[model samples]
Target chain A: MKLRESVIDKSIVQNFLVDAVRKFSPYCPGDLSMATPLIRTGIVDSLTIMEVTKYIESCINTSLPVAKINRESFRTLEALSDMLFDFIKEHNLDLDIDGLKGMG
Target chain B: MDNLGQVLERSINLYPDDVALICSGEQVTYAQLGERVAQFASYFSGLGLNKGDSVAIASFKSIDVVSVMQAALRVDLVYVSLDPRFPPERLKELIRDAAVSVVVLDEFLSQEWSKLEFLPDCIQYALTLHDEKKLEIKSDVKCHNFKEINSDSNDYKRFVPQRKGEDLAYLLYTSGSTGKPKGVRITHDNALAFVEWAASEFEFSQDEHFLNHAQLSFDLSVLDLYNAFLAGARVTLLPEDDAMFFSYVVNLIRDDQITNLYMVPSGIIGLMDKGALMKEAMPKLKRILFAGEKFPVTRLKALLDWVEPNQEVYNLYGPIETNVCTFSKIKTDIVFRSECPIGEAISNAQVALRQDNGIISYDGEGEIVVSGRCVSPGYLNSPILNKSKFFLQDNHRWYCTGDYGYFDKNKVLWLKGRKDNLIKIRGYRIELDEIESHVQDTELVDDVVAVFHGSNSESGAIVLWCVFNQQALDSYGSIDIVVNLIRQKLKSVLPHFMLPKLIKSVKELPKTNRGKVDRLKLKERGI
Candidate 1:
């Protein structure tokens, strides 16, 4: 019943996160950094968060537990990607890096 | 008893010590709220404002703004709610169109107000709330601070004017297809009908803590504000900044123990995405109502699973022209085929489907025609719009809702789509909403919007813009894979001609100010 951890490329995950932020966050500045606070800076509202979360789940192929969708997890692009990576590691799910690029 | 002012007065008399409103950490009892309303009324009277005159209020949602609105109602003045977020030019246009004689606004908006080049000739004075210091205005209009007016001991009993049922209560300006905002004139009776029906339908009581989520300018606030007063229920106003934050909103609801909640589908989806319902049980939350736009079935199912078993959910349907005319209760037993039904008409409204042949149909598709006490008088000062939108047929004044729908076998009304949104692609009639609903049903997609490009002739093509679900993207591992999956799913339900000519994957769809999908913007992008 146990699932094996799937190998994921960190660069691919970072690239996907960048694309999601650029497409979903309309008000987001062009030079948005990985450490930027999307909600606090008004770059993204609740709707954008939903879209971003959905995009993340699709890339990783897993449903995020309610507990992982807090403010800390969604603080920035780095934080969100790290959380997804952690989820992938914990659940032992496989990541498809080439497939992730097509999504981006 | 015919207007909101009377409702507030009744609530004060019935529950003087009960909390009437909580805004920005300030809780006001019914008695205190009444006194402040009276004080504002007296101040307005001192400034020579008379019955039937328009008073424009441009401020954030707060206790002072609520008091000013009630004060205008008490003095029989037409209160015009203006969104302060609007640019100066748009605000000036609305103020000019409303022919407002006075304006009550927050000091924070002083800079923007001063930038306005044109001021309505009727606007003689401006009252600034929140700041004790006087504001320096560049115009000839006189400005007064709230402290100066509130401290006056003048009796307000004599200032209360007798208002008829047909008298103008408020003017709400909504964006029209013509790219201009048209004000909708709602009368005392027009609002009272909806308020009265909602109070009884929801079975609201004095202890009900209702959440005011919509902006004051939006007509949805009519239900949030007046319905609570009609039943002597406490209203908890969500500030504009905090309303944008999902976690903050959930915390507010849990902390305040809000009993009744009203919001648009997008707001509800945001809460669901952030695990608002799953994190903790909102035990005090009794009724959750959504309106303004359609709620995707997948999201609604998630919400239903998250809430308590006994809690009630409703899908209310109506345009700004008529305050909620039809409502559908989201019962646990009812099965949703695609979208939730708009249900039956309210107590004071009648809904009928009018076919293309100018006849009413019970079980087929047609434009929803609403006739009854809740229908508004018509658009303010727009005779052309009034003539086209409002008509008298068979001795009944009916407002033609541009939305298309039909009554099911069980007599429940189901909205199909907007009449204007229907497109003819290569001589094939296609409903944009129908395509969207089918695409949304796909497990791989989170949201979908179908728009038509080009003329109605054979040259036109349909474009399907979709946002893929994270889980699906993860499983498929590529955008091409997700798109292929969606195309395959859509192929079974749609014909070859009805299939999308171009499928574009987007991160998110643009939304209008009222929170509905911004199709006009999508078309403008020519994607």
Candidate 2:
């Protein structure tokens, strides 16, 4: 079923964000958590960030702010989730709830 | 200076205290670099690797990896660079094809160690670049840490090794349409042809600090590494993992005071799109070079505006088979409407367009052929391909570039389109069949056709249309789920850039009248 971007639970969105990094990252030195450094450790680059962004946009059925694709938003899983949640709250766009469940 | 070994030794003698390499804010002087290269060369000789033997270097970008490359050249050993980002299976295939004797791997690749089972049976040893580490592998290949040589006290006095110019220097593997990687064999003379011409033509001196934006595996790095030593100049190494980050790239260029920058156009395009690159940001960047893929004219125009009047932009063009045979200094008044001119052939080479009916024309539209010291002998271990792609005509052997282009009245080259499905995404050469071959290996699909969408710009993407087999049909619930599952599976097996941007389920892919998968039609249908 369809859902408003704001209707999604915060923790669920965070889980999705974490899941995206874990699924796409080539190197996860440790069990990746919300605090794992994505940019500083050189685990994710700009291109990998784009893949993670695309996967999130694929699940949400919407494109993200071009600004959100920067290194700051991708600093960590926590940072990415925080940025996506705030952007979702601001936009309040439509999302395919099932699509979120289907992806990593 | 008949060989690169002489280039290194001469550079060390002439510029002992000058900076040779820089990475991560650490500068390595030519003397220090010479000592490391000599140590590696002596250690490799101790390992019994003869002059003609081929060693494979598989590592992430680092100063040590560059050292190993120079050492291999010092001892007159042929070396091939293996991208650590490639799938382990693909790595094995390349190793087996090249008959790689030993693999110099990065610590990142050795994290889980050889448990990935990527090393082929032919590899006699695996050299991991870490101080102290353990590798877990079931194979008989001996594993050792690189520090074993670096930390040892056995001092072997460095000496120059005189090697023949016709001997093999390195093997570069490119995506072959035949569903396998083809190794292009380059010799010392072939490499010197480009380096000597480039160093003098570009006026590289001890003062020029170069930036290596491409991986060592890519031929684009040839200019980055060789030209520096030839000119007794300094070159900065950019780590492969950090090549995509805007801040890392800009900070390195600004702080390092990089003067000569060589990279694919898409890299700068991405930075410019984010509004990060300013004319004043890199004041020391004097020579801006782009190669590997076409730089869209619109972005090229923007780049011209972004760089100061003193800074020069150049378009360096060549396939891997011919290492940069032609180059053009870009200007505000460009002749081509949508693309930059490839310029006339360099001083060391000649370029001719050959028609299908055995006619070689210097001006008209046809497959571009390069002949001279710049032309590689042929693909290693592929005699059939060597015969077909390279030919002896008019007392010169020419390597036919699969690209169809023409020479204008000014004798400048303009790219029309590819005569094959080979595509370059962000300057990485990829074959449509390469992705399809891997997808077929998954055994989940009855058929698959991969098509490239968009220009070679940042917007470029690969899309795959797959027909599920009976096994997949019974195992999967929906097309969406199946597509997602395939993507996750492919992620572990294909290089990141080669991964399909999208996948779709199909009962059957549409075909053209020739009963071949209609790539053009499918590409148009892709997002």
Candidate 3:
């Protein structure tokens, strides 16, 4: 059976996000709960913002326009996932795995 | 050396037609340059200018500016650069502090500021060419064409210096931390010490072509300009815009066969970003030296990987008070997350660590104090500061450099950070530098800054401000992942309270006039 829409396992997305953060920020680690304020607390300066935004756009298979990139979507992981999902769904995507998996 | 005039005469006798001064497209040979300076020196003397008097040279870094500076020196007068970019208030203050007797400015800036009356200290004001007609009525001060003065008296002679060493050559002011600027009375001996050291240390050949990028007001420019003169090497003074352009720099190096490059980290990074070396910009480039700020390890590593292994990269460190005091040469292969060691002190200089209690030691982290011929006499007119900071200890005067660092067992000096940058947050004292260290350590993060802010209710408690890496976010889009990474890293080294309550990533860190990270502006903008 084809994996139904909304049947996504978030574990894959979460783990990939962690690895990506670790690779980009070698000085900092990749745990999500602890790094919630990466944007809010002033950890991600402008140079890192552009770099991370480009990376996120490529992974989600969508062009993240500069205008859409704001504090709301960049504030947290949950917000970013929702933004990415909506961005994908607007194009009439078939599935939204528990917010992860199968992309790589 | 008292032999400056003699050397000039010798150079004129030998390389009469060799290119000496090149401003824009205009070129003047050694003989012409020598003649021009002597003529100008005599012209100033004919006007009754005395030794020890201050003459303000307010112009861009052109050949004329260099000629005027040398003329002032030859006539035994101190040459002060009236930087056009300096704030009016600072300029006025410097005019008063230095007791400047004459002011020389170019045409463009003179029109905008010709009417503003300087303080009573400045007695004469003259405009360089093109502004001669702008001033409707001139004061009692004598004004003459800088160019005409040189061409008029080819046979003019100057009364060369009878006294040499302790006589004040020029007053280079510190960047002014405590509201009032402090002038460092750099003697002839002090300037010559660094010039002689660099000329010998670099093995400056007669064939080497040099580039002068820094402003004359900056002490670093002294090394660039004088080192060239010391070696009798040809120097090309780069425009500010051209120095900032990677393509232009590459072209200049390749076409001019520029053999030596002494610049700040920004210039180096710009060239790297433009892939200047990827196209083989300068096949003849041999030396690369960067100073003023810590060179980013990531950018430096990539630059080293791209450039020739034989091309030397020297990390030169020193405060304005000491002229290029310490140097650490890095091998192309060495990679460091933190700042490279300031290296061992240069020849004839001694760097020692002084703790709060004032014990000089070699090992422990403390204030990096320098005691040697390189030390400035102290601030002019500020006796209190001179008494406190610049003190005679063990029969020698030492300038207490506020920077904090320690010497390794191998005798290499590693700077930790600034001592004055400590902040108290919620009863926990934290060095703002510690946050910077963490930021630099993070690979995903290109730039990070931690600023101390106070809550609306509390007056002194600290609020944390941060900016993260943009490149990482584009690839990962995981804010939680980055925060978690930083939190985990800090959890082991920093206490729980030290963790920033708010994490906000921005596009860039604000920089001040000196290209240093500005926290005050960040606080004003908020997260």
Q: TM-score for candidate 1, please give it.
A: 0.72
**TM per candidate, chain B:** 0.80, 0.94, 0.77
Ranking by TM-score: 2, 1, 3
Q: What's the CA RMSD for each of the models?
A: 11.6, 4.5, 15.3
lDDT of each: 0.77, 0.79, 0.64
Which residue pairs show collisions in model 2?
none
Model 2 misses residue B147 by how many Å?
2.2
Query: In candidate 2, what are the lDDT values of residues B197-275, reduced to their tens digit?
Result: 8977888878988988888999989989888887889988887655766656776678778898888888887667643
Of 2 and 3, the candidate ranking higher by lDDT: 2
Cα lDDT, model 3, residue B19:
67
User: Comparing 1 and 3 by DockQ, which wins?
Assistant: 1
Per-residue lDDT tens digits of candidate 3, residues B1-527? Answer: 64233334444566677766555667787777777777767766676766789887766667767777777787778888755544444566787789887766666445545566543446565636545464422346555665454445665244465535667778886444343556778877777777777877788876777877666877777877777666666778875334434555676778888888887675566556542544288777778888876676766777777677767778888876777788988887664647677888878578888888888877878998887877777778888877877776777678887788988778789888776655433222345665556556766567777676653111222334446567777666787777666666654344332445455677777899999888789788754
Q: Candidate 2 chain A: worst 10 consecutive residues by lDDT? A: A95-104
- Name the top TM-score candidate: 2
In angstroms, the error of model 3 at B307 is 2.6
lDDT of 3 by residue, A49-71 (tens): 44455566556545665445655
Model 1, global lDDT:
0.77
